[model samples]
Target: MTQDPQTSSDASGAPASSRRGLSRHLVDIAPLKASPAFARLWIGGAISGVGAFMTTVAVGLQIYEITESTFAVGLVGGIALVPMIAAGLWGGVLADVFDRRKVVIASSLASWASILALVVLAFWEQHLQGLGTHAPVWPFYLVTTVNAITSTVSNATRGSVVGRILPADMLSRATALNGISFGAMVTVGPALAGVLAASIGLPWTFAIDAVLFTAGFLGIWMLPSLPRLGERVEAGWPVLKEGLTFLRRSPNIRMSFIVDAIAMTFGRPYALFPALGALVVGGGALTVGALTAAGAIGTMLTSLFSGRIAHVHRHGIAISRAIQVFGAFAVLFGVFTWVGMHSGHAAGEGWGGTDFSTLALMALAMAGMGASDELSAIFRQTMIIQAAPDEMRGRLQGVFIVVVTGGPRLGDMYAGALAAVTALWFPPLLGGFVIIALIVILTRAQRAWREYDATSPTP
Candidate 1:
């Protein structure tokens, strides 16, 4: 009888290994072990991420404190969106044409400078005796906008560099590690920002980010030069048009972007957290922090045990299913908020009041939603990075950043506008249904997308 080649034989010619290898399904760390450069970059980014989140929270608090209007606070994201989009696209072209290491290093310095400017402004505001509650909002916007643009470019450049550093088989595990880094950033950064801003004030928060920015510089500086491969194109409108044309031809890639846009646009409920904490959940700032961190906690946990996901072959189906689960959790979160609001709990109360039961339920729902979204992100990113050619990876990674970042900004607008007319709970409840139904219909129409295989990527 013929024997299977995969099975090991004993000295007596009997099969020695019959049990299947479960380790193959586990999160593979070969990429980290094989490449020292990738490891340094990853560690630096993770450390810097904590500082970045601190400034993000501090800036929003400063804006709201000065203006006292939700509209003004929302405008922070809206104002930066257009310039960020342009930077993302333009940066992609530059990454393809220039040395990626130089692009990243230059952009990192610009970001560091912007953070330093913020520190100076914060000090100026504190020293002025008669400034009262309001500090100049324009400078805050200006520095943040500059920071946003430079950070976008640097992120796009680094993403393109990942493909060059790691092998194709290890891409999925690398993405999982990235998700873990992001999870840590979101979880720890905001919490630290709140404590630091309250105790040490805004200047120190910005200063911390400025100091951490050096790690990013060090990581980029250590990398070997990465010049453009194959035919090079000038960084201009023609290059941008070429990338778009390629995107237009790749249906699977287009669908990945569309699905993510849909999920973020309809299901994101972060804009309502402040209102819900104060008037509905009754824990005020503490409640808001809990809700915000819950999602990141879920993301971190999912990535920690992402052993099984590495073996998934049908990426499209996995993405669609994960997103659907995310939508379902969003619906549950909305329902919990609505019930809590009507349950005679303390409304509009400050931080001292507690509503543990309702807060726990809402947090659980948000955690579920976060985990599912992270799963989908891992698959979608892996598909793009592995499927796209090395030459076009930079341009595509730029587009990916734009979609991922821009989608939430659009969602903020959607949730804020709808909550103004209706209750804060109405938008997520309705939007969740929209996300589920729309994704189902869209995926059904694209048969090729549902059947996408990792071993043989179509796009």
Candidate 2:
């Protein structure tokens, strides 16, 4: 029941008696006003996330353009999976063993260097095409894989440190704010990348992403030293083994991961976007950007009104219900895509002439999925961060990152492979049904997870 010294003051950094009333239904900004360090960290991550998302859209599009295969584009996530998992595991151990601030800064630099390499190769490819030969696709894959490895380390290190800076009561609010940041990243980044890639080209698009990454440096660099909080653990096999052992013992924490994997593995439809834009939905890159951004709009709207969620203590039930809604929306999205395909909409000039009516309906469905997913994520994150003890938080957070990230990679494969055999619409339609059924079965079987109460966290 002890609190973080950094969050000791009221969120406004004012004496409790003098504070004015704030809306309970709005996103609480107290975390920002209460701790200068958290504010800087949040700001830096928010700015940098925009650039990261931009790079994600650009990379996916580039691969699709090169191979003309949705499966190849989906392979981007599969390619990074093994390396990212290793980095996330070892990075968690490193976070627990060394200074977390330094770990993040080092990883950030490595990630930046990888992005710069992308910029160089992009321009080089442009030059090559102008003369005779085109640059090899292997280099792009290699650099992105390296970036994924570094990014996993940075994410694990940074995620583990948030608990050190914020009080337990504010954790929910902090997560909600992160949702807003995530919303902005997806909303702004993909849209901008689509415009830039269509107008300027990939070289400049990559260069802009490189420039934006600098903001993250200020966030991690300015944080106070964050060493391990409890019993010391070295980075080795024993530590990794210990982390897994703890997860085995904690059913609630374990269940959180399982449910998320179900939702992401079955419900995610991102891998289909490039193909939809190119063939089914038309408007190419613009359609891709709009479809991606549509989900963010829902995420942002949900987060903005998240003030009331902090009062809810039944996090497990809340997570279960939210993901069910997410599945329903996924099914809706599949229906829209199927309808658009059957309607025989003429392909536009890659940026315009999209079937606005069908696109709008699909975007609406995607937005619903985003909102529900964000709600589930807030509670899942809060549950993990709050339930785990100080010494084990790093490792648990690492696993959380793995589930959060790895599931999507697997989903990319699922969607890509299924779409390859069937049609783009079939994966989401069938997957959505699977997610809804699996979540219900899993939660019902895991009684402890279904009955988890936030007021008395068991992990």
Give each prediction's root-mean-square deviation over alpha carbons: 4.1, 3.8
Q: In model 1, which runs have C-alpha deviations exceeding 4 angstroms? A: 1-26, 124-131, 282-284, 347-351
Tens-digit lDDT track of model 2 for 46-161: 89999998998998888787678999888888888888888888888888788899999999999999999999988888898799767778888899999988998898888888
Go through the candidates in order and give each one's C-alpha lDDT: 0.81, 0.87
TM-score of each: 0.91, 0.94
Q: Candidate 1 residues 66-168, lDDT tens each?
A: 6654555556667788898998898888898899999999999899889999999888777762555556788898888899899989999999998999877
Scanning candidate 2 in windows of ten residues, the lowest lDDT window is 11-20
